[model samples]
Target: MRGKYTIKEINRIPELLKKGKEYKITYDKDKKYTFIGCGSSYNLGLITTKMLNKNGYKSNVISGGEVIVFDKVPQTDIGIFISRTGESTETVKAVENFKKRKIKTIGITCTADTTLTKVCDETYIFEFANEESVVMTGSFVYILNFLLNGIKKIDIIKDAETVLSKIKEQIDTIDLKKYNHYVFLGYEEEYGISKEGALKIQEMAIQNVEYHEPLEYRHGPKSILNEHTLVVINSKDTKKEAKLAEELKNMEAEVILIGKGKDIDIPYNNGYETPLRMILPQYLGYKKALIEGYDPDQPRNLTKSVILD
Candidate 1:
Protein backbone atom coordinates (compact mmCIF):
# COMPACT_ATOMS: atom_id res chain seq x y z
CA MET A 1 0.00 0.00 0.00
CA ARG A 2 2.92 2.28 0.69
CA GLY A 3 5.64 1.59 -1.89
CA LYS A 4 3.90 -0.45 -4.57
CA TYR A 5 0.22 -1.16 -4.70
CA THR A 6 -1.12 -4.50 -3.59
CA ILE A 7 -2.33 -6.97 -6.23
CA LYS A 8 -5.88 -5.85 -5.63
CA GLU A 9 -4.85 -2.27 -6.19
CA ILE A 10 -2.97 -3.19 -9.34
CA ASN A 11 -5.97 -5.10 -10.73
CA ARG A 12 -8.17 -2.05 -10.19
CA ILE A 13 -6.02 -0.09 -12.64
CA PRO A 14 -7.84 -1.66 -15.61
CA GLU A 15 -11.20 -0.47 -14.39
CA LEU A 16 -9.87 3.01 -13.86
CA LEU A 17 -8.53 2.85 -17.41
CA LYS A 18 -11.89 1.78 -18.81
CA LYS A 19 -13.57 4.74 -17.14
CA GLY A 20 -11.27 7.16 -18.94
CA LYS A 21 -12.05 5.34 -22.17
CA GLU A 22 -15.66 6.45 -21.96
CA TYR A 23 -14.53 10.06 -22.41
CA LYS A 24 -12.59 9.42 -25.63
CA ILE A 25 -13.06 12.44 -27.86
CA THR A 26 -15.72 11.31 -30.30
CA TYR A 27 -17.15 14.76 -31.00
CA ASP A 28 -13.85 16.56 -31.54
CA LYS A 29 -12.47 14.57 -34.44
CA ASP A 30 -12.50 17.52 -36.83
CA LYS A 31 -12.29 20.18 -34.15
CA LYS A 32 -8.99 21.50 -32.87
CA TYR A 33 -8.26 20.35 -29.34
CA THR A 34 -5.42 20.47 -26.84
CA PHE A 35 -4.31 18.62 -23.72
CA ILE A 36 -3.64 20.75 -20.66
CA GLY A 37 -1.84 18.85 -17.92
CA CYS A 38 -0.16 20.80 -15.16
CA GLY A 39 2.93 19.76 -13.18
CA SER A 40 3.46 16.01 -13.43
CA SER A 41 0.22 15.87 -15.31
CA TYR A 42 2.01 17.84 -18.02
CA ASN A 43 4.23 14.84 -18.52
CA LEU A 44 1.12 12.69 -18.81
CA GLY A 45 -0.17 15.08 -21.44
CA LEU A 46 3.02 14.60 -23.41
CA ILE A 47 2.50 10.85 -23.35
CA THR A 48 -1.16 11.30 -24.23
CA THR A 49 -0.43 13.63 -27.14
CA LYS A 50 2.13 11.23 -28.59
CA MET A 51 -0.18 8.25 -28.22
CA LEU A 52 -3.14 10.11 -29.69
CA ASN A 53 -1.03 11.24 -32.63
CA LYS A 54 0.07 7.67 -33.17
CA ASN A 55 -3.58 6.56 -33.30
CA GLY A 56 -4.58 9.25 -35.82
CA TYR A 57 -5.90 11.74 -33.31
CA LYS A 58 -4.50 15.25 -33.60
CA SER A 59 -3.60 16.82 -30.28
CA ASN A 60 -0.98 18.94 -28.57
CA VAL A 61 0.24 19.54 -24.97
CA ILE A 62 0.10 23.05 -23.55
CA SER A 63 -0.17 24.51 -20.08
CA GLY A 64 -3.83 24.57 -19.12
CA GLY A 65 -3.56 28.14 -17.94
CA GLU A 66 -1.52 29.25 -20.91
CA VAL A 67 -3.96 27.79 -23.42
CA ILE A 68 -6.89 29.65 -21.94
CA VAL A 69 -5.43 32.99 -20.82
CA PHE A 70 -2.50 33.73 -23.14
CA ASP A 71 -3.19 31.78 -26.31
CA LYS A 72 -6.31 32.55 -28.25
CA VAL A 73 -7.71 29.07 -28.33
CA PRO A 74 -10.39 28.64 -30.96
CA GLN A 75 -14.00 28.38 -29.80
CA THR A 76 -14.35 24.84 -31.06
CA ASP A 77 -11.34 23.61 -29.14
CA ILE A 78 -11.69 21.22 -26.20
CA GLY A 79 -9.60 21.25 -23.03
CA ILE A 80 -8.34 18.24 -21.16
CA PHE A 81 -7.13 19.46 -17.76
CA ILE A 82 -5.30 17.01 -15.46
CA SER A 83 -4.45 17.73 -11.84
CA ARG A 84 -4.36 15.54 -8.80
CA THR A 85 -6.14 18.05 -6.56
CA GLY A 86 -8.03 19.91 -9.31
CA GLU A 87 -7.24 23.06 -7.34
CA SER A 88 -4.42 24.56 -9.39
CA THR A 89 -4.94 28.28 -9.87
CA GLU A 90 -3.92 28.25 -13.50
CA THR A 91 -5.93 25.14 -14.22
CA VAL A 92 -8.97 26.54 -12.45
CA LYS A 93 -8.64 29.88 -14.22
CA ALA A 94 -8.22 28.14 -17.54
CA VAL A 95 -11.32 26.04 -16.96
CA GLU A 96 -13.24 29.07 -15.79
CA ASN A 97 -12.26 31.06 -18.86
CA PHE A 98 -13.39 28.22 -21.09
CA LYS A 99 -16.61 28.00 -19.10
CA LYS A 100 -17.24 31.68 -19.73
CA ARG A 101 -17.08 31.02 -23.45
CA LYS A 102 -19.08 27.78 -23.15
CA ILE A 103 -16.17 25.83 -24.56
CA LYS A 104 -16.13 22.04 -24.17
CA THR A 105 -13.80 20.70 -21.52
CA ILE A 106 -12.82 17.45 -19.82
CA GLY A 107 -11.24 17.15 -16.41
CA ILE A 108 -9.01 14.33 -15.25
CA THR A 109 -8.38 14.37 -11.54
CA CYS A 110 -8.54 12.35 -8.36
CA THR A 111 -11.27 14.45 -6.81
CA ALA A 112 -14.61 14.13 -8.58
CA ASP A 113 -16.09 17.25 -7.00
CA THR A 114 -13.34 19.73 -7.80
CA THR A 115 -13.89 22.99 -9.71
CA LEU A 116 -12.41 21.54 -12.87
CA THR A 117 -14.66 18.50 -12.58
CA LYS A 118 -17.75 20.62 -11.97
CA VAL A 119 -17.08 22.82 -15.00
CA CYS A 120 -15.92 20.27 -17.55
CA ASP A 121 -18.43 18.53 -19.81
CA GLU A 122 -16.93 15.17 -18.78
CA THR A 123 -14.68 14.02 -15.96
CA TYR A 124 -12.52 11.00 -15.31
CA ILE A 125 -11.83 10.52 -11.62
CA PHE A 126 -8.89 8.31 -10.75
CA GLU A 127 -10.08 8.12 -7.07
CA PHE A 128 -6.70 6.86 -5.99
CA ALA A 129 -5.65 7.97 -2.52
CA ASN A 130 -2.12 7.04 -3.47
CA GLU A 131 -1.51 10.53 -2.22
CA GLU A 132 -0.96 12.03 1.26
CA SER A 133 2.62 12.90 0.32
CA VAL A 134 3.74 15.91 -1.69
CA VAL A 135 5.01 14.03 -4.73
CA MET A 136 2.52 11.82 -6.51
CA THR A 137 3.46 8.13 -6.73
CA GLY A 138 0.75 5.51 -7.39
CA SER A 139 -1.63 8.17 -8.62
CA PHE A 140 0.66 9.19 -11.47
CA VAL A 141 1.24 5.67 -12.69
CA TYR A 142 -2.39 4.75 -12.18
CA ILE A 143 -3.79 7.68 -14.12
CA LEU A 144 -1.29 7.43 -16.96
CA ASN A 145 -1.91 3.70 -17.31
CA PHE A 146 -5.64 4.35 -17.16
CA LEU A 147 -5.42 6.81 -20.01
CA LEU A 148 -3.25 4.48 -22.08
CA ASN A 149 -5.51 1.50 -21.54
CA GLY A 150 -8.53 3.61 -22.32
CA ILE A 151 -7.23 5.30 -25.47
CA LYS A 152 -5.54 2.24 -26.94
CA LYS A 153 -7.43 0.11 -29.46
CA ILE A 154 -9.41 -2.59 -27.73
CA ASP A 155 -7.46 -5.38 -29.40
CA ILE A 156 -4.23 -4.06 -27.96
CA ILE A 157 -5.62 -4.08 -24.44
CA LYS A 158 -4.71 -7.75 -23.98
CA ASP A 159 -1.10 -7.08 -24.87
CA ALA A 160 -1.17 -4.18 -22.44
CA GLU A 161 -2.39 -6.48 -19.68
CA THR A 162 0.50 -8.81 -20.28
CA VAL A 163 2.85 -5.90 -20.14
CA LEU A 164 1.36 -4.74 -16.87
CA SER A 165 1.83 -8.18 -15.44
CA LYS A 166 5.42 -8.16 -16.55
CA ILE A 167 5.98 -4.87 -14.82
CA LYS A 168 4.76 -6.39 -11.58
CA GLU A 169 7.14 -9.31 -11.98
CA GLN A 170 10.06 -7.01 -12.75
CA ILE A 171 9.28 -4.87 -9.73
CA ASP A 172 9.34 -7.94 -7.55
CA THR A 173 12.92 -8.70 -8.53
CA ILE A 174 14.79 -5.39 -8.87
CA ASP A 175 17.33 -4.53 -6.12
CA LEU A 176 17.05 -0.77 -5.91
CA LYS A 177 19.62 0.10 -3.20
CA LYS A 178 22.55 -1.62 -4.90
CA TYR A 179 23.57 1.66 -6.56
CA ASN A 180 23.73 5.12 -5.03
CA HIS A 181 22.79 7.24 -8.05
CA TYR A 182 20.88 6.46 -11.23
CA VAL A 183 21.29 7.76 -14.76
CA PHE A 184 18.29 6.78 -16.88
CA LEU A 185 18.97 6.44 -20.60
CA GLY A 186 16.54 5.93 -23.41
CA TYR A 187 16.04 6.84 -27.05
CA GLU A 188 13.32 7.18 -29.67
CA GLU A 189 10.06 5.61 -28.45
CA GLU A 190 11.22 5.35 -24.86
CA TYR A 191 12.67 8.83 -24.47
CA GLY A 192 9.74 10.34 -22.63
CA ILE A 193 9.55 7.38 -20.30
CA SER A 194 13.19 7.94 -19.47
CA LYS A 195 12.46 11.54 -18.55
CA GLU A 196 9.46 10.52 -16.49
CA GLY A 197 11.47 7.82 -14.75
CA ALA A 198 14.20 10.29 -13.90
CA LEU A 199 11.63 12.66 -12.42
CA LYS A 200 10.22 9.83 -10.33
CA ILE A 201 13.65 9.13 -8.89
CA GLN A 202 14.16 12.79 -8.10
CA GLU A 203 10.74 13.17 -6.55
CA MET A 204 10.81 9.90 -4.67
CA ALA A 205 14.46 9.35 -3.84
CA ILE A 206 15.77 12.89 -3.86
CA GLN A 207 19.09 11.41 -4.86
CA ASN A 208 21.47 12.24 -7.68
CA VAL A 209 19.50 11.28 -10.78
CA GLU A 210 19.66 12.20 -14.45
CA TYR A 211 18.15 11.07 -17.74
CA HIS A 212 19.33 11.18 -21.36
CA GLU A 213 18.95 9.24 -24.50
CA PRO A 214 21.71 6.69 -25.15
CA LEU A 215 23.36 8.93 -27.69
CA GLU A 216 23.00 12.00 -25.49
CA TYR A 217 24.58 10.22 -22.53
CA ARG A 218 27.69 9.50 -24.57
CA HIS A 219 27.84 13.14 -25.65
CA GLY A 220 28.36 14.47 -22.09
CA PRO A 221 26.35 12.56 -19.48
CA LYS A 222 28.81 9.68 -19.65
CA SER A 223 31.53 11.74 -17.97
CA ILE A 224 29.68 11.60 -14.61
CA LEU A 225 29.19 7.87 -14.51
CA ASN A 226 31.17 5.36 -12.44
CA GLU A 227 30.50 1.87 -10.99
CA HIS A 228 28.34 3.53 -8.34
CA THR A 229 26.12 5.21 -10.92
CA LEU A 230 23.26 2.83 -11.65
CA VAL A 231 22.54 3.28 -15.35
CA VAL A 232 18.93 2.54 -16.25
CA ILE A 233 18.37 2.45 -20.01
CA ASN A 234 15.03 2.18 -21.72
CA SER A 235 14.80 1.36 -25.43
CA LYS A 236 11.68 0.65 -27.40
CA ASP A 237 13.24 -2.73 -28.13
CA THR A 238 15.92 -4.11 -25.84
CA LYS A 239 17.47 -6.40 -28.41
CA LYS A 240 18.26 -3.42 -30.59
CA GLU A 241 19.86 -1.40 -27.76
CA ALA A 242 22.01 -4.25 -26.46
CA LYS A 243 25.13 -2.77 -27.99
CA LEU A 244 24.62 0.45 -26.08
CA ALA A 245 24.22 -1.56 -22.87
CA GLU A 246 27.43 -3.40 -23.70
CA GLU A 247 29.23 -0.12 -24.06
CA LEU A 248 27.99 1.05 -20.67
CA LYS A 249 29.05 -2.20 -19.07
CA ASN A 250 32.44 -1.90 -20.71
CA MET A 251 32.74 1.47 -19.00
CA GLU A 252 32.09 -0.28 -15.65
CA ALA A 253 28.75 1.39 -15.21
CA GLU A 254 26.13 -0.76 -13.50
CA VAL A 255 23.53 -1.05 -16.26
CA ILE A 256 19.92 -2.11 -16.02
CA LEU A 257 18.20 -2.49 -19.38
CA ILE A 258 14.48 -1.91 -19.86
CA GLY A 259 12.07 -1.80 -22.77
CA LYS A 260 13.40 -2.99 -26.16
CA GLY A 261 17.09 -2.89 -25.22
CA LYS A 262 19.02 -5.85 -23.83
CA ASP A 263 22.64 -6.25 -22.73
CA ILE A 264 24.74 -7.04 -19.66
CA ASP A 265 22.98 -8.22 -16.52
CA ILE A 266 20.39 -5.90 -14.89
CA PRO A 267 17.16 -6.57 -16.79
CA TYR A 268 13.53 -5.65 -16.13
CA ASN A 269 11.62 -7.28 -18.99
CA ASN A 270 7.90 -6.85 -18.76
CA GLY A 271 6.93 -6.62 -22.41
CA TYR A 272 5.99 -3.41 -24.24
CA GLU A 273 3.52 -1.53 -22.04
CA THR A 274 4.80 1.96 -22.68
CA PRO A 275 5.10 4.20 -19.61
CA LEU A 276 3.27 1.85 -17.31
CA ARG A 277 5.91 -0.81 -17.84
CA MET A 278 8.46 1.92 -17.23
CA ILE A 279 6.95 2.26 -13.77
CA LEU A 280 8.68 -0.93 -12.57
CA PRO A 281 12.17 0.17 -11.58
CA GLN A 282 10.74 3.53 -10.59
CA TYR A 283 8.45 1.88 -8.06
CA LEU A 284 11.45 0.01 -6.78
CA GLY A 285 13.32 3.29 -6.43
CA TYR A 286 10.45 4.67 -4.43
CA LYS A 287 10.75 1.79 -2.03
CA LYS A 288 14.46 2.33 -1.73
CA ALA A 289 13.88 6.01 -1.10
CA LEU A 290 11.37 5.20 1.59
CA ILE A 291 13.72 2.77 3.31
CA GLU A 292 16.52 5.31 3.16
CA GLY A 293 14.49 7.71 5.41
CA TYR A 294 12.96 9.77 2.62
CA ASP A 295 9.24 9.75 2.03
CA PRO A 296 8.49 9.01 -1.60
CA ASP A 297 5.01 10.42 -1.17
CA GLN A 298 6.26 13.74 0.16
CA PRO A 299 9.57 15.00 -1.13
CA ARG A 300 10.93 18.30 0.14
CA ASN A 301 9.44 21.57 -1.24
CA LEU A 302 6.92 19.71 -3.39
CA THR A 303 3.15 20.04 -3.47
CA LYS A 304 0.32 18.13 -5.05
CA SER A 305 0.06 20.77 -7.78
CA VAL A 306 1.26 24.26 -8.53
CA ILE A 307 -1.10 27.23 -8.41
CA LEU A 308 0.60 29.52 -10.87
CA ASP A 309 -1.44 32.69 -11.21
Candidate 2:
Protein backbone atom coordinates (compact mmCIF):
# COMPACT_ATOMS: atom_id res chain seq x y z
CA MET A 1 0.00 0.00 0.00
CA ARG A 2 3.02 2.27 -0.13
CA GLY A 3 2.27 5.11 -2.55
CA LYS A 4 -1.28 3.80 -2.90
CA TYR A 5 -2.64 7.14 -4.14
CA THR A 6 -1.35 7.63 -7.61
CA ILE A 7 -0.68 11.21 -8.67
CA LYS A 8 -4.09 11.01 -10.30
CA GLU A 9 -5.92 9.80 -7.19
CA ILE A 10 -4.19 12.42 -5.08
CA ASN A 11 -5.09 15.09 -7.64
CA ARG A 12 -8.79 14.32 -7.29
CA ILE A 13 -8.70 16.47 -4.18
CA PRO A 14 -9.99 19.43 -6.22
CA GLU A 15 -13.07 17.59 -7.36
CA LEU A 16 -13.57 16.28 -3.86
CA LEU A 17 -13.48 19.88 -2.77
CA LYS A 18 -16.23 20.71 -5.21
CA LYS A 19 -18.29 17.77 -4.09
CA GLY A 20 -17.88 18.81 -0.47
CA LYS A 21 -19.04 22.32 -1.27
CA GLU A 22 -22.09 20.93 -2.98
CA TYR A 23 -22.87 18.52 -0.16
CA LYS A 24 -22.09 21.00 2.57
CA ILE A 25 -25.60 22.42 2.51
CA THR A 26 -27.03 18.99 3.20
CA TYR A 27 -25.82 19.21 6.79
CA ASP A 28 -27.37 22.21 8.53
CA LYS A 29 -27.96 21.07 12.08
CA ASP A 30 -26.03 22.95 14.76
CA LYS A 31 -26.72 20.53 17.58
CA LYS A 32 -24.30 18.59 19.77
CA TYR A 33 -22.64 15.35 18.65
CA THR A 34 -19.97 12.80 19.55
CA PHE A 35 -17.00 11.48 17.56
CA ILE A 36 -15.65 7.96 18.05
CA GLY A 37 -12.54 6.06 16.99
CA CYS A 38 -9.50 4.19 18.34
CA GLY A 39 -5.76 4.63 17.75
CA SER A 40 -5.14 6.55 14.52
CA SER A 41 -8.88 6.94 14.04
CA TYR A 42 -9.06 8.52 17.49
CA ASN A 43 -6.56 11.12 16.34
CA LEU A 44 -8.80 11.75 13.36
CA GLY A 45 -11.71 11.99 15.77
CA LEU A 46 -9.98 14.90 17.51
CA ILE A 47 -9.48 16.71 14.22
CA THR A 48 -13.07 16.09 13.14
CA THR A 49 -14.39 17.56 16.41
CA LYS A 50 -12.40 20.73 15.80
CA MET A 51 -13.80 20.96 12.32
CA LEU A 52 -17.30 20.49 13.62
CA ASN A 53 -16.82 23.37 16.03
CA LYS A 54 -15.41 25.56 13.31
CA ASN A 55 -18.53 24.88 11.28
CA GLY A 56 -20.79 26.04 14.15
CA TYR A 57 -21.58 22.56 15.45
CA LYS A 58 -20.98 21.40 19.02
CA SER A 59 -19.18 18.07 19.37
CA ASN A 60 -17.37 15.90 21.93
CA VAL A 61 -15.17 12.81 21.88
CA ILE A 62 -15.31 9.39 23.57
CA SER A 63 -12.93 6.49 23.01
CA GLY A 64 -14.64 3.81 20.95
CA GLY A 65 -14.12 1.03 23.45
CA GLU A 66 -15.14 3.14 26.46
CA VAL A 67 -18.31 4.70 25.06
CA ILE A 68 -20.48 2.51 27.17
CA VAL A 69 -18.49 3.15 30.33
CA PHE A 70 -18.07 6.90 29.76
CA ASP A 71 -20.52 9.54 30.99
CA LYS A 72 -24.00 9.65 29.51
CA VAL A 73 -23.85 9.86 25.72
CA PRO A 74 -25.32 12.88 24.00
CA GLN A 75 -28.57 12.50 22.07
CA THR A 76 -27.38 11.84 18.52
CA ASP A 77 -27.27 14.87 16.19
CA ILE A 78 -24.16 14.39 14.09
CA GLY A 79 -22.10 11.48 15.34
CA ILE A 80 -18.80 11.06 13.46
CA PHE A 81 -16.75 7.85 13.50
CA ILE A 82 -13.44 7.32 11.78
CA SER A 83 -11.60 4.07 11.02
CA ARG A 84 -9.23 3.40 8.13
CA THR A 85 -10.72 -0.07 7.99
CA GLY A 86 -14.45 -0.46 8.74
CA GLU A 87 -14.06 -3.58 10.90
CA SER A 88 -12.60 -2.19 14.14
CA THR A 89 -14.95 -3.72 16.68
CA GLU A 90 -14.85 -0.84 19.12
CA THR A 91 -15.94 1.69 16.54
CA VAL A 92 -18.56 -0.71 15.22
CA LYS A 93 -19.95 -1.24 18.68
CA ALA A 94 -20.06 2.50 19.30
CA VAL A 95 -21.95 2.99 16.04
CA GLU A 96 -24.44 0.33 17.10
CA ASN A 97 -24.94 2.04 20.45
CA PHE A 98 -25.47 5.40 18.78
CA LYS A 99 -28.04 3.90 16.45
CA LYS A 100 -29.85 2.35 19.36
CA ARG A 101 -30.12 5.81 20.89
CA LYS A 102 -31.56 7.12 17.58
CA ILE A 103 -28.56 9.36 17.07
CA LYS A 104 -27.66 10.57 13.58
CA THR A 105 -24.40 8.87 12.56
CA ILE A 106 -21.85 9.77 9.90
CA GLY A 107 -19.03 7.35 9.24
CA ILE A 108 -15.67 8.10 7.74
CA THR A 109 -13.93 4.90 6.69
CA CYS A 110 -11.70 3.42 3.99
CA THR A 111 -13.69 0.28 3.18
CA ALA A 112 -17.24 0.49 1.88
CA ASP A 113 -18.49 -2.75 3.42
CA THR A 114 -16.96 -2.54 6.91
CA THR A 115 -19.10 -2.84 10.03
CA LEU A 116 -18.92 0.87 10.79
CA THR A 117 -20.39 1.70 7.38
CA LYS A 118 -23.06 -0.91 7.70
CA VAL A 119 -24.19 0.62 10.98
CA CYS A 120 -23.80 4.31 10.08
CA ASP A 121 -26.63 6.43 8.67
CA GLU A 122 -24.29 8.36 6.37
CA THR A 123 -20.86 7.17 5.28
CA TYR A 124 -17.99 8.61 3.26
CA ILE A 125 -15.34 6.25 1.97
CA PHE A 126 -11.89 7.15 0.69
CA GLU A 127 -10.66 4.88 -2.09
CA PHE A 128 -7.13 4.17 -0.93
CA ALA A 129 -5.13 1.13 -1.98
CA ASN A 130 -5.21 -1.82 0.41
CA GLU A 131 -2.67 -1.49 3.20
CA GLU A 132 -0.52 -4.66 3.51
CA SER A 133 1.00 -3.40 6.74
CA VAL A 134 -0.69 -2.77 10.07
CA VAL A 135 0.09 0.96 10.06
CA MET A 136 -1.98 3.27 7.84
CA THR A 137 -0.52 5.83 5.41
CA GLY A 138 -2.55 6.89 2.35
CA SER A 139 -5.79 6.07 4.13
CA PHE A 140 -5.08 8.65 6.80
CA VAL A 141 -4.46 11.31 4.17
CA TYR A 142 -7.62 10.26 2.37
CA ILE A 143 -9.69 10.75 5.53
CA LEU A 144 -8.00 14.09 6.07
CA ASN A 145 -9.05 15.17 2.63
CA PHE A 146 -12.62 14.21 3.48
CA LEU A 147 -12.58 16.42 6.57
CA LEU A 148 -10.93 19.39 4.86
CA ASN A 149 -13.28 19.23 1.93
CA GLY A 150 -16.46 18.28 3.76
CA ILE A 151 -16.46 21.25 6.07
CA LYS A 152 -18.32 23.97 4.16
CA LYS A 153 -17.36 26.94 6.23
CA ILE A 154 -13.84 28.21 6.80
CA ASP A 155 -14.28 27.78 3.04
CA ILE A 156 -10.74 27.05 1.91
CA ILE A 157 -10.95 23.66 0.26
CA LYS A 158 -9.77 25.12 -3.04
CA ASP A 159 -6.77 26.70 -1.37
CA ALA A 160 -6.00 23.50 0.55
CA GLU A 161 -6.29 21.52 -2.65
CA THR A 162 -3.76 23.85 -4.26
CA VAL A 163 -1.46 23.60 -1.27
CA LEU A 164 -1.62 19.79 -1.27
CA SER A 165 -0.84 19.77 -4.99
CA LYS A 166 2.24 21.85 -4.42
CA ILE A 167 3.19 19.69 -1.46
CA LYS A 168 3.00 16.62 -3.66
CA GLU A 169 5.30 18.33 -6.13
CA GLN A 170 7.86 19.03 -3.42
CA ILE A 171 7.44 15.53 -2.03
CA ASP A 172 8.19 13.98 -5.41
CA THR A 173 11.58 15.68 -5.57
CA ILE A 174 12.96 15.94 -2.04
CA ASP A 175 15.62 13.56 -0.67
CA LEU A 176 14.76 12.71 2.96
CA LYS A 177 17.54 10.13 3.51
CA LYS A 178 19.74 12.82 5.01
CA TYR A 179 18.12 12.82 8.46
CA ASN A 180 18.25 10.10 11.10
CA HIS A 181 16.24 11.56 13.97
CA TYR A 182 13.30 14.02 13.89
CA VAL A 183 11.56 16.36 16.30
CA PHE A 184 8.00 17.53 15.62
CA LEU A 185 6.63 20.71 17.27
CA GLY A 186 3.17 22.21 17.06
CA TYR A 187 1.25 24.38 19.47
CA GLU A 188 -2.51 23.98 20.11
CA GLU A 189 -4.62 21.87 17.74
CA GLU A 190 -1.77 21.11 15.38
CA TYR A 191 0.03 19.22 18.14
CA GLY A 192 -1.93 16.06 17.33
CA ILE A 193 -0.57 16.14 13.81
CA SER A 194 2.94 16.56 15.13
CA LYS A 195 2.34 13.50 17.27
CA GLU A 196 1.03 11.58 14.27
CA GLY A 197 4.03 12.65 12.19
CA ALA A 198 6.34 11.54 14.97
CA LEU A 199 4.54 8.20 15.18
CA LYS A 200 4.89 7.71 11.42
CA ILE A 201 8.65 8.14 11.62
CA GLN A 202 8.91 5.85 14.61
CA GLU A 203 6.75 3.13 13.08
CA MET A 204 8.05 3.23 9.51
CA ALA A 205 11.59 4.55 9.56
CA ILE A 206 12.33 3.03 12.98
CA GLN A 207 13.78 6.46 13.73
CA ASN A 208 13.98 8.50 16.91
CA VAL A 209 11.54 11.43 17.02
CA GLU A 210 9.59 13.42 19.58
CA TYR A 211 6.49 15.63 19.38
CA HIS A 212 6.18 18.53 21.81
CA GLU A 213 4.58 21.92 22.12
CA PRO A 214 6.77 24.66 20.64
CA LEU A 215 6.99 26.42 23.99
CA GLU A 216 7.47 23.15 25.87
CA TYR A 217 10.41 22.35 23.61
CA ARG A 218 12.18 25.40 25.02
CA HIS A 219 11.67 24.14 28.59
CA GLY A 220 13.65 20.89 28.12
CA PRO A 221 13.24 19.00 24.81
CA LYS A 222 15.77 21.26 23.11
CA SER A 223 18.71 19.48 24.77
CA ILE A 224 18.78 16.65 22.18
CA LEU A 225 19.51 19.03 19.31
CA ASN A 226 22.20 17.92 16.86
CA GLU A 227 22.91 17.75 13.13
CA HIS A 228 21.39 14.27 13.07
CA THR A 229 18.05 15.62 14.30
CA LEU A 230 15.53 17.36 12.07
CA VAL A 231 13.58 19.89 14.13
CA VAL A 232 10.20 20.35 12.40
CA ILE A 233 8.23 23.28 13.79
CA ASN A 234 4.57 23.92 12.91
CA SER A 235 3.83 27.56 13.61
CA LYS A 236 1.89 30.46 12.16
CA ASP A 237 4.50 33.02 13.08
CA THR A 238 7.60 32.64 10.92
CA LYS A 239 9.61 35.16 12.98
CA LYS A 240 8.95 33.24 16.16
CA GLU A 241 9.65 29.99 14.34
CA ALA A 242 12.91 31.52 13.07
CA LYS A 243 13.92 32.25 16.66
CA LEU A 244 13.42 28.58 17.46
CA ALA A 245 15.26 27.69 14.28
CA GLU A 246 18.13 29.87 15.43
CA GLU A 247 18.26 27.96 18.71
CA LEU A 248 18.28 24.64 16.80
CA LYS A 249 21.01 26.01 14.53
CA ASN A 250 23.14 26.80 17.55
CA MET A 251 22.59 23.22 18.66
CA GLU A 252 23.39 22.05 15.08
CA ALA A 253 19.88 20.75 14.47
CA GLU A 254 18.36 20.89 10.97
CA VAL A 255 15.14 22.97 11.01
CA ILE A 256 11.99 22.58 8.90
CA LEU A 257 9.18 25.07 9.53
CA ILE A 258 5.59 24.90 8.23
CA GLY A 259 2.98 27.67 8.30
CA LYS A 260 2.45 31.41 7.87
CA GLY A 261 5.01 34.29 8.02
CA LYS A 262 8.70 34.44 7.13
CA ASP A 263 10.87 33.69 10.13
CA ILE A 264 12.92 30.68 9.17
CA ASP A 265 14.18 29.67 5.75
CA ILE A 266 11.58 26.91 5.72
CA PRO A 267 11.86 23.95 3.42
CA TYR A 268 8.65 23.43 1.40
CA ASN A 269 7.15 26.65 2.64
CA ASN A 270 3.45 27.16 1.76
CA GLY A 271 0.56 28.95 3.40
CA TYR A 272 -2.57 27.08 4.40
CA GLU A 273 -5.54 28.60 6.21
CA THR A 274 -6.65 27.06 9.50
CA PRO A 275 -5.56 23.75 11.09
CA LEU A 276 -5.68 21.90 7.80
CA ARG A 277 -2.08 23.09 7.48
CA MET A 278 -1.05 20.52 10.06
CA ILE A 279 -1.75 17.65 7.69
CA LEU A 280 1.11 18.65 5.38
CA PRO A 281 3.81 17.13 7.55
CA GLN A 282 2.04 13.79 7.67
CA TYR A 283 2.14 13.81 3.88
CA LEU A 284 5.74 15.00 3.90
CA GLY A 285 6.84 12.40 6.44
CA TYR A 286 5.08 9.61 4.56
CA LYS A 287 7.05 10.50 1.43
CA LYS A 288 10.25 10.47 3.46
CA ALA A 289 9.45 7.03 4.88
CA LEU A 290 8.91 5.50 1.44
CA ILE A 291 12.24 6.84 0.23
CA GLU A 292 13.94 5.37 3.28
CA GLY A 293 12.98 1.80 2.36
CA TYR A 294 10.15 1.47 4.87
CA ASP A 295 6.74 0.19 3.92
CA PRO A 296 4.14 2.46 5.52
CA ASP A 297 1.44 -0.01 4.50
CA GLN A 298 2.65 -2.45 7.14
CA PRO A 299 4.50 -0.88 10.01
CA ARG A 300 6.71 -3.30 12.00
CA ASN A 301 4.18 -4.56 14.57
CA LEU A 302 0.91 -2.67 14.15
CA THR A 303 -2.59 -3.97 13.37
CA LYS A 304 -5.11 -2.60 10.84
CA SER A 305 -6.86 -1.01 13.76
CA VAL A 306 -6.61 -1.46 17.52
CA ILE A 307 -9.56 -3.34 19.05
CA LEU A 308 -10.19 -3.19 22.77
CA ASP A 309 -12.97 -4.83 24.75
Instruction: Please write out the lDDT profile of model 2 over residues 2-55, one tens digit for every residue.
Output: 745433334454454455443332344567777788877787666666656656
Q: Candidate 1 lDDT, tens digit per residue, 55-128?
A: 66677777765765685454447777888888877777777666677777888888868777877888877665
Query: What is the alpha-carbon lDDT of model 1 when measured against the actual structure?
Result: 0.64
RMSD of 2: 4.5
Instruction: Itemize residue pairs with steric clashes in candidate 1.
Output: 134-298, 237-260, 237-261, 238-260, 238-261, 238-262
Overall lDDT per candidate, in order of appearance: 0.64, 0.65
- In candidate 2, position 304 carries an lDDT of 70
Per-model TM-score on C-alpha atoms: 0.77, 0.75
Among all candidates shown, the one with the greatest TM-score = 1
